[model samples]
Target: MSRTTFTLDDLKRILLEGSGVPEGADLRADILDTDFTDIGYDSLALLETASRVEREYGIELDETVLGDATTPRAFVDAVGAHLSAQPV
Candidate 1:
């Protein structure tokens, strides 16, 4: 088995694409530091993005983390941590 690695930027892209952010929407770098609420993502949006992450990475994310992560950076960190712990 081999481990897969992804960066915060990768996760950011995934979130932008999976969270139903509309076309022509301006996604600024502040997304990395801003709350998802500020970025117009709600619980449903996060859930959808989390599902995408799980499917893409073939890993299970803890529901608590999925639900509680407030910012894109936090989500990226949580997923990265979980992915690092998965068996390779």
Candidate 2:
């Protein structure tokens, strides 16, 4: 089933599975506002994560929007917005 909202937990799981967590990066910590770059997630990693999220959720996420989402919170919010716009 498709999801209606994207949460931080989802991001963490996807990040781990899609790109593998970087060394010394603590995903379990409070990283909502932490910049993706700070945690070793670069544009390529974020793109991969976005691709995985799109495939899993059956929603298309704009690359530009994803690029704008520098933090996990913003990424989740961007995915949530796309999910909400999808047909029920």
Candidate 3:
């Protein structure tokens, strides 16, 4: 089974598991539009998150798209797009 859509909750879980949430970084808040950097996740953390997502979802993410996704919303949207394109 595979995911057909990417959600904020999914990103939150992967972030927490792949790279523990930083102290004071509230994943409980509405952080979809917040930049990952602003939420204590650096480029490295995002990379790790992307890796986890790729392995878990069995999909290869476009690095250029990932690089352009600065916020959770953008990241989620990017993943959702890929997921949507996958063969069902």
Candidate 4:
């Protein structure tokens, strides 16, 4: 039950690399703790990000958890939890 540790930078990268985020919208470090809506992410973008995470980590994340994630840390935590629960 080892969870793959993902950094904030990794989350940012996923957001940037994945589609739906406003083009050229800078995801500054200061905004990691900010709400996704405040940071300019729409629901579709979040869903896309979740899809990418699931595909990248090969884990099925809870949609409810992902939908409720307002900050990058929350998303990271949810993903980490899912990863940790995975069979080794």
Please report the candidate that would top lDDT against the real structure: 3
**Residue by residue across 1-88, what tens digits does model 1's lDDT show?**
2337767667667767877574544575556777777777778878888888888888888989866689777887888888889876
lDDT of each: 0.75, 0.89, 0.90, 0.77
Worst 10 residues of 1 by lDDT: 20-29
Point to the candidate with the largest TM-score: 3
**lDDT digits (tens) for residues 4-60 of candidate 4:** 766677788888888635655667657767888777787888898888888888888
What are the per-residue Cα lDDT tens digits for candidate 2 across 1-88?
Answer: 5778889999999999988989889998999999999998998898889889989899988868776899999999999989989888
Sort the predicted structures by TM-score, highest score first. Answer: 3, 2, 4, 1
Which ranges in model 2 have alpha carbons more than 4 Å from their true place? none
In angstroms, the error of model 1 at 74 is 0.8
> TM-score per candidate, in order?
0.80, 0.93, 0.94, 0.83
- By summed lDDT, the worst window of 10 consecutive residues in model 4 runs over 1-10
The ten-residue window of minimal lDDT in model 3 covers: 1-10
Candidate 2 residue pairs in clash (backbone atoms < 3 Å): none
What candidate 1 gets wrong by more than 4 Å, as runs, is 1-3, 22-25
Better by lDDT, candidate 4 or 2: 2
- Which clashing pairs does model 3 show? none
Candidate 2 minimal-lDDT segment of 10 residues: 59-68
lDDT, residue 30, model 1: 59
lDDT of 3 by residue, 1-88 (tens): 3677779999999999989989899999999899899999988899999999998898999988668999999999999999999988
